[model samples]
Target: MDTRNITYFIAVFEHLHFTRAAELLGISQPTLSQQIRLLEAEVGMPLFDRIGKKVVATEAGRLLHQYGMKMLQAEMDAKNAIKELRSENRGTIRLAVLPSDLDFQLVPLFVDFKTRYPETSLQAFSTIFVREEVLAHKVDLGIGLSGSLDKRLVQVPLGSEPYELFVHSASELAKRQAITLEELTQHALVMYPKGYLGRDLVDNVCREQGFELNTVMEVGSASSLLQLVEAGIGATIQPKELLKQHPEWSHIVSIPIADPAPIRHLELTYYADRFISKAQQQLSESLIEFFKSRGVGEDLELRG
Candidate 1:
């Protein structure tokens, strides 16, 4: 029953001599014999056969040795796993990020992360609803477009850029290098649903500039919105970074919106209610550093 006694039994069983086993265990021979007797009594079986100075393990002793060894190994394994986690030498980080982050932000950092922490790994889910995912504890950290967040959440700004409008390459609007708020409003516009990232920024900017924010269609998914824009269904306003990432959108051409730009910020957000794991914190540092190295995000601060 007692693990210490089991250890003593193992030592005695292996040595087959009480004096030698006690010497190996750093205990007296009398103490070892008394503990072995107590262990046998608790198990209701004789663990050893004593014939004068000769000692050998009984059936019960051999069985206990097998099971006891297993228990000890399991405990060692648990301790080792916890130690690795505490040391940040190993663990998986559950993270969520917008689809746009995969291209310019997360991908490059992931390469460096893997190289630095080879024993660790990541579970990533990409979507437009990064905040919701983090709030629900579905992911440990999230990187997405910034907006008002719950008080329980903390956000670290990574980078930001002014909003831009993308149109079909064949559209007459694409002939110009840039567009104005008034000109973009003259045509039908594709937009994200209410509460979606960049939705408020575009709408507010349109109102501030005295242009009506006309929405010809509304969608929840970023991919679908981009597809509609590429097909020339309607023009759409999105962060400049998204446009930079997907140059393969051959059907799409973007025009910059001039001065006093309506901007969207990208950020790393986590729940302030929970402890930030080493892997998650490491990732945030890597992201901030990644952006800084590229001469972007200079004004951004690494959030505590």
Candidate 2:
């Protein structure tokens, strides 16, 4: 019945080892066992099957685990709401950032944020995409080369990350300042896997140019695609700003794709109806300001 007991139970169920779970929860094994016993008594069911050193959750335990997580998350959300009301400057920002922004933009902003509001905690999740995270309310904000999501979500356009041809030094495509989407199809390609926004954008443009892409290889991350391009395997496409960091990859040339210059809009997405705490608002403002300061004003647009 107790929330603390539920927390302890979930931790134990997750690890299926009392000692390991206790360590993770920063408590003693004996104390953890006592709490789990108390939880089992309250529920009137055996939560675990113990045989030798192995432990497994019983059917009841598995069901409780699912509900227990939802209860705990709701409790945490309530606590966060109260904390937000007490202090405008002190709180956490739950952000889910795409991998490219992790290095190019988010890290530096995080450094500055820590210095400015040392009391604030930043919970950052760096993933390939954040649309699902935002929709699930697991993250308060998300940044990516994407646009709108479900109708429940609202997006603030930051900028368009111009797609450029990333080619290895010896590749014939590296000789040009720009290549049309029509010309891009002539070479072999390394592209993002299907369903990824970047890959979708490239596919859309190539389709517009009246041909399917010659994607010889497919990769999940921008880094892998770039590495493959560097290895002279095939050309790939990525944001111009991300490519700017690796000048040493001078072996690679990033030329803008012309004739319907393909680009993905990088946007900040969040649930429109959710409460925007001061910490969240400030972080969003900081991102907008940072973009303007970096002279990306021409590319970035702040959505109302």
Candidate 3:
């Protein structure tokens, strides 16, 4: 029932290896094992079952893990609340963003936030699984494409933008103001790999329309994908906001997609019960304002 022991247990459960967990925790393997054993004895049940070299959590272990995370989160929230009472702008905010042009686009907003709260430590990284990261309490907040409803999360609608065909100014398609989804299939295209959220959004729409794009290249890096378009290699389908953010990429023109344009809905998500520090609250407001300034989420309702 010791919080320290519960911490050790969670570490071991996450890594599923004593030596690895011990190394991460900066403790010896024997010491970590002893802590786990003590925890198991205190709980009066086997927490893990060892099968050869593999370690698997038992039914009890899984149940403890579910509540253990909340307990630790609550403890941390209490500490953060106390700290905020002393100084409103002195805490760390961990944010996860979609691994695409959106990350680069938000750089200016991040810079402004840092300037306003110099004492606040902001750690932002790009990930494809923004929803999962936020749900697991791995990050204080996340910004990504709208996902399925989860009661544990507070999702604020950032805005929705239409997917447009991006091509080099010199490309033949650039002369057209808009292109139909069916016509887009006739041209060579470069896109994100299969599992990416943005790519999947467009793909799903294509499937619904009874067609698939003629993608000639699949590049995971957002910069590289745009570079391919700049090189006149192939067209790409992306949110129009992406090109609007990069004035340096003036050579690239985003033409609207007609006949039911694919739209990407963006949302800022965080745990509903998690304490929102002043720094986190301000940053969230900044994000909402930033998107509004860009003329993206005008019609979307603000929800938390």
Candidate 4:
């Protein structure tokens, strides 16, 4: 019943002598005898046979020894697991990110983070989640286009994503290096599905420039939109960084918008109340340093 008594009993069982067991356990011989007696009374079984100057373990004592070994092992294992968890050597970090983040912003950082902490597990879910969901602790953190967020949510601006109209090289619209929103609307616009965050950003910019979207097809994902654009189905507007790595897309003309130079804020958002784990904290530091080295943090603004 009592672990202290069981420990003493195990020591005595192994040594087969109270005096020697007490010496091994750093306890008095009389105290070891009293603890063994208490263990026997609690289990309602005499665990030892005394024959004059010698003591031998009974059936009950042997059984308890087997179970007591298991209990002690389990406790030791639990302690080791907790230590590893606190040290960020083992644990799961839940992350929710926008689909676009996989291309330029999050992919490199994720690769670096994994390399730095190979033991910490990452559970990633790509979604069109807003800051409110992050604030609610629905996910540990999120990476997406930044905007005005709830006061409860804290956003760390990673950088700015520049907007450009992507069109086929041979298309009449691609003749110019950069074109206006007015010029882009003249052609059929293939874009994200309505209510999507990226589409919302494009729509907001269009509205600010005082025009309505003339869309040809609505796509569910960025990859699908790029594919359609590549096939010359229709031209679409998207972040410039998304096309940076692909030289094939270079043939596709990208005309930066004039005047306001439409740009979206990219950020790493998490709940203010949430206590960031060691892994998350390390990740946040790595991200900030990466962004700063690239000159992204020079103009970062924290959104509430």
Candidate 5:
């Protein structure tokens, strides 16, 4: 069985579309189909079942996919090992981070990283599904909410920050040092939708307190949420660090949430079995140091 065939099979299995997989692999649809047929012949079984336009993996295909990921990971490990022997620090490090963090929070850290490691390429994707991307091996690392029991992932605590009410400085709420979770219902609020991790955290806390937030608007973009707040559309609850990072938002004031403040715990997550290249390790270290300098997760500790 050629590793190349296994690679093609995995791509097709993931997309469940021949043309889509072919496009991703830089090959023609016929060439991809021929490769899959060759792989099926070599394995003595059909890997995918075609039901009309739907492509579903057969039992054999599922089994192959399980081990095929490991085989490819091993190949990557071997290449990384050889590259390490040559002391090469140049490679692409793909990472996924929450959109909220990417926009205003972690810009300085990324800038510093690129300045220090000009030879290495950094690709940062802003997404809400950080853990899913990391688990699927679509990204080398992820920065998002912690608390995963998946043994396949290694999560390092980044820090925890409390959710604060962000409002225009002229708002009455801004005059106070803090506000209770229940008090949020009294004011019109702009927030992320229910399914988003940040919104879910706040919703869960509200449910625990036996009340729901009076959200007047639901916006997906963090920056948009802030703009709405600035426009006096409504107040918003977000991590305290967001306001601290954006000093130019002088009109925006953040007041701490009291009566059981909601805190977002973040972690640096990556696949446990995947080999960590030197470049990846450096970036991870830089992230930890950056958080420490900002006094986030004050009791932070490095954990596997």
Candidate 6:
């Protein structure tokens, strides 16, 4: 129950080894094990499963670790709040960034941010679960999938991004100017797992056209999907911005989806309750301005 014990528990869970966790925590292996046992006694359940040489978290351990991480992060956020008041220009800003955002938007934005706040540091995490991390205070801002979010979070709509069919130049479909939702079903497709916004859009269109989806390969990474498409193995659906950013995909052709393009809005997500430092606020403003200058700010909206 103690934060110190929770910290030790988190360290062990991260490394999944007593010696490594002890080294990281600056404590002896026996002491760390004793503390973990005391924590297990307090929680009334086993946290980890140590079988042979491997150490893994039990189901109970996973749940407790999630809560412990939130507690530790909240504590850090409180300290940062005080530091923000005392210090003028030196602090770390953690931002959870989506992979798609990195290639196109982040470099210029990062350059500007660093130029303005030279003393500040930026940590960018490539993640899809931005809202959860923001609420936990693990990140100050995040690039989220869609405009919709919980009432406790604040969001600024970046713009609506349409999914396009990425086909290999050698493929017959690449010669075509545009492709429809129905025609797209005829080819073997590379897609992400369910719950991804791009995947959801593909499913919606496929369902609307009255065809059972046939996936050739389910890929996890966006970069890998492009590689598969370029290899003529399968076609993938991705955002226009993402494809445009990666111009090195000369063999990969991007075709605009027709008969109602699959579009979803991208947004900036942050917790309303968390303190937004001056540098954070400035970066947010600059991002909004960047979007505006790009001529995609018509549907912009702010919500808490």
Query: For residues 53-166, what per-residue lDDT tens digits would candidate 4 score against the true structure?
Result: 899999999999878865654554466557766674656677787776564456777787898889988877778864655654556677767767667678889887678888
For each candidate, what TM-score against the reference?
A: 0.62, 0.69, 0.96, 0.66, 0.93, 0.75
Using TM-score, rank the candidates from best to worst: 3, 5, 6, 2, 4, 1
| Candidate 4, residue 276: how far the Cα is off, in Å | 1.4
lDDT (CA) per prediction: 0.78, 0.79, 0.88, 0.76, 0.90, 0.82
| Clash count per candidate | 0, 0, 0, 1, 0, 0
State which candidate, 1 or 3, has the greater lDDT. 3
Better candidate number, 1 or 5, judged by lDDT: 5
1-304 per-residue lDDT for model 2 (tens digits): 9789998998888789999999999999999999988888989999999999999999999999877866776777688788777766577789998876685556778989888878888998988668778865678898866654457777777766677888887987767878887776788889988888777887888787688887889988777888899899999888777777556676788887885877777678877766677778889888877766755534554453
Best by the lDDT measure: 5
Candidates 1 and 5, the one with greater TM-score:
5
For model 1, residues 37-151, the per-residue Cα lDDT tens digits are: 9998999999899999799889998898767765654554466557766685667678897765664446767877999878778888878889888775667788887767567
Judged by lDDT against the true structure, how good is candidate 1?
0.78
**Model 4, residue 281: C-alpha shift (Å):** 1.2
Runs in model 2 deviating more than 4 A are 1-78, 85-89, 149-151, 294-304
Q: Candidate 5 — worst ten consecutive residues by lDDT sum?
A: 295-304
lDDT of 3 by residue, 139-180 (tens): 999998887777888888888889999999999888897889
Ranking by lDDT: 5, 3, 6, 2, 1, 4
- Write model 6 residue lDDT over 82-191, tens digit each, in one string: 89889885677788977657645677888988998898888889877877778766788887776555897898888876778899999989888898877766889888
- The RMSD (Cα, Å) of candidate 6 is 4.3
